[model samples]
Target: MPVVFIHGVATRAGEQYQRGVAAREELIRRLLVDRMAASDPRWAGMQVVSPYWGDLAVRHYWAQATLPPVGTLEDMGVGDDGVAAADLEVADLVKEIGNDATGLEALGAETPLRNAWSKNPHRTVEALLAPIVHSDRSVLRPQDLGITEQARPAQALGEIDGRVLAAGSLAASDEAVGAAIRDALSDDAALTVITDAIVARTEQVAPVEASTDSALESLGPGWLDTLRDRVGEVLNRAKSAPARVATLAALDRYRDGLHGHLTLFMGDVFVYLLRRGEAGSPGPIVERVREAIADAPRSRADEPLIVLTHSMGGNIFYDLVTTYEPSLKVDLWVSAGGQVGQFEEMKLFKASTVVDPPAPPMPPKVAALGGRVRTWLNIYDPADILSFLVEPVFTDPDAGVRIKDLKFKSGVSALKAHGAYYSRPTFYELLGREFGSRP
Candidate 1:
């Protein structure tokens, strides 16, 4: 059976190294073998294939000769000069924002997504980095800490400022002029923009001491309230950039804003997802997917043709099925960290029919189910900014092909959660259940 894999957008180099695909593939194989119960005939030979599409985006950037700001995503766990590096990054972004020559161009050729500062470099660095940053998770959420509305942590700026400075994160010269960059990095915003770099600066292990716990209680009755308040204050301070830019209410909103911008194709795939447009010719991503499946071990009647996808790879897959509607027999379509859910607002595109549910699966059904896909499983992390739920559109109860959305947690924090999918229990469970023995 041919098992095809597709990846999501911004699959940076660090993720590949951190996961070590060869080793990960072996781990998957073993998991399937162990879970198979040694009784299933189908378990004889089923391999997990993970396609690397990161290089495509990377290559595109290079072809344009436009070097995107690539941070060193080292695995060094919050040690040494990591905090210093983060500080430097903030400083660099500030400089870039202040300087007219270094402004983020109108259309970044790499991902070609829209940027508030796309045309205006001097506006604020945060606008350009909005989609890439992961600061949304850390801010707001007053209920998490049981903090009352009257004493909301929105005014905790003083405490947050002290803690951030003590951490040695922001330094002199650089600290003086940080408007857009400061706003973005102010609260986990930095986490999204410079993922690997932030990881290296952050501690991998849990905190040994309750250093902040007592201090938090001192601030208020609930620790979550205290922490949230402090960060809220910092985010407020971040918004108070010298001149131009947005004044954010909470960092999470800014954090949440980046998700859609990341998918801007120099165009909108959402429109097609919303309103069925004329079937146009395929693009570069199409050619790539076509080639990938073509080169994969050919699928057979007895063999299950399973395709696993992640992030933007799912978007590409969406485009693939919607436009090309390839005459290939697809068995299981598993998407993780996918944006297809965002693309399909009201229409369902499963079983080769655009099912606008509450209504029957739409008309203009495929001529036959011979080449149509069977099942689709979507997996996502609540904390992951880049991913979305795809079950609504792709899952049609009438299609007879099962489509389910599973919320998976990788136990990773910040933007790194987007890349931490491979190491999750969900990863193992899905593979084992699909390729291994049932029951």
Candidate 2:
């Protein structure tokens, strides 16, 4: 039972990117490395593996996609402004053609313009200049017109006059004559290039790898089921006193079934003497922990299988020991910043069928194992809000091992309660002494 660390919600894989701030990743790295170092002598040769779950990817995709554009407008600039201005002048020519329709009729000729420009001058201009303004080869900028930076105004005036003449050649019936004139005055190549560039940039920054199915499969067979069942059973037992007793009974039954590797059931998140259910099931969290454990090489039977869990992780470990791996005895059980002492839900135990009588202090589950299990050390920082400051909880009379609470100032001054127990040197020293290689 290698020390398995189960991160809290939103801290899993894929979700790492969603941490947003750099500090979060740093903190996680520090905690992980520190834990490994603390387990140095006991787990000196063991590996530390962090599962790359997909929570971060999901979070990033949802959050980044909705952001506003960040680049400057100049970055998208094209010389289309001159062409646009020329299109404006073409409308005047279209209007002249429309008004001359009556004169053309007198001359026995059909109206050259299709519609009256008087109704909408803007449309008339757009129709006459559309082609030339939209053409790829058209050079609508000051540079293309051979005009210096200082002579842009003069060049623009000259271009506008030329566009007006181009619009005049179209028949009155040609409603799009004005659009063609404007099209001749501007170059669309620059605009096209800019648009393509913007699209390419957008695609480049898009996120990749948004799921983590592969990561989960890295664990061995039947791992998921074992984890789920263990968590469910422990959570169910913690709900009632009788169920807690029943849970102990169930552990005993399982112990009798297995032959090799003895089992030691730890307490729920609450570290207090009371078997009250405080921390929830360890199922989901344990899945990752198990995966990491599976990554390590299996050892000899005598080698201690140490499990060091904190907060809710301790609860999960307890479930696994009693329900799933009864014969697989844990050599050392280290609980830090534990919340098992605060379990308020003992009613669930009364309703359980596992216990003969469903009330009062629940009986220990280890009795069924006939004392094969060894040491159980429960460590706590006084500042940890979740642990009991003055007392201990998980005492096994038959096993003669009492739950111990160790106190230290967690150095962290802000949230001076729960998390620091995992980071402090004293906790590390205790872990190293039990699990680290003995020199």
Candidate 3:
């Protein structure tokens, strides 16, 4: 058996994209393919193939300049936190910088056979600079600053919580600790100020009082110089902009994350509709899918051909199997968070032949798929606004096995639910139980 994965819109070529594909492949292999093999030996060695068609998706000629910026406070429906509703969605971006830095320091602490201070000298330096850089808070008690490895973890963790608090603060007033952090983070000379302060403090505090110059020397001087630069890069995003402007910036990112992807989703839909080309000369997107199907291993006649499509990819496959290549056989068709039913209802697809004014139960093109597609499983999340019910829109009582619409609760916020299917291990578990484990 071979499983073909068709990705949705708003996808691009990047590290995140690559990581997502790899994760999906490995997950499908474990949850679905392994279960199928367990049920029947014929399903052994099933390969998961994800064909890339994101290149043919929407392109912004004006560099997406048409998109609007963050709205005014009143327009955004300001929340109790004083951050706009949209801004609240993306506030994690501001928090993650400090969290990552703290996590790095924590990782250093856990690194065995080495003192936490020596494991990540840069993070230690970052912590040391935090009090002077942002505000004066006693992160390290005098007792915690001892030179021994036993006391080093406490010293390493000294200023992490304070730094996080400062960076994550969204206080309205300029006198707030967050404001101080933002100012310090933005200053070009802050690094120099921090470096000089650290040198003075280290000289005055540790080795001179405790006579542990060799321990300080063990970390080397090169580390001291490079550490500031690295930590500077680490905290660069924590500053962003301050006060109201900072909220707007966060809102802007939220809109781009959601609305921008939605714009591209519609763009991909339109692009596929207008430029699908004839069967003889299929467009780049359709042609890509055709090639993937053709490449599937069919050494044994009994081998099942499974097609898993997400979001717009579902519509693409539905159109391809029904109209572009009617003979194309899909033993199992799994659509997650897709719009095929909605597209059919709207009569947008090339194969859409469902008449209006008391519209027919099943579109002719969809009925045609009954022969080629053995089992159609449509998965939709209640929170996902984009996913639609295929069973209601397309049905064939005579066929006995109609499209099964499984209502899944993705336990994510509405804005984040649509793209949450593939990333969830529980989603794969559902697929295994519904389709793969069956004899």
Best by TM-score: 3
Query: For each candidate, what TM-score against the reference?
Result: 0.45, 0.36, 0.58
Ranking by lDDT: 3, 1, 2
Candidate 2 least-lDDT 10 residues: 260-269
Root-mean-square deviation of every model: 18.9, 31.8, 17.3
Task: Write down the lDDT of every candidate, Cα atoms only.
Answer: 0.43, 0.34, 0.55
Ranking by TM-score: 3, 1, 2
On lDDT, the leading prediction is: 3
Residue-level lDDT of model 2, residues 1-439, one tens digit each, is: 3334433222232211222112122222232333454554443333222343223212333533444443322321123232222222232233344345433231221221223233433333233333222221121233433334432323232222222222221222243433432333222322222223322322322221222112212223322223223222322221121212221222232222122111111212222123322333333334445555566453333334656666655544554454434445555566666544443123122112244573467544322222333666666666455554213334455545434555554332223335444422233444445546221
> Where is model 3 more than 4 Å wrong at Cα?
71-253, 298-301, 354-356, 359-366, 397-400, 436-439
- Candidate 1 off by > 4 Å: 12-19, 33-39, 58-281, 298-301, 346-371, 397-399, 430-439
lDDT of 2: 0.34
User: Candidate 3 at 91: error in angstroms?
Assistant: 12
The per-residue C-alpha lDDT of model 1 at residue 373 equals 67
Across residues 1-439, which tens digit of lDDT does each residue of candidate 3 receive? 4889999888887534544454455446545765787977766667777899988878899977887774433443333332232232223222322233442232222211112122322232333323222222223322333434543332232222222222211111123322333345323343334333433333322221121112223332332333334334433322321233333443543454466667887888788888888767788899899888898665366778989999989988987987788888777889999999998878777777646654456434356476678789999999899999887677654465657998776444476668767654456656766764631
Compared to the true structure, candidate 1 yields what TM-score? 0.45
Q: What is the per-residue lDDT of model 1 for residues 290-374, given as tens digits with 9 covering 90 to 100?
A: 6677676632347666677767677667656655655566767778877777655533443244554535453332332233667
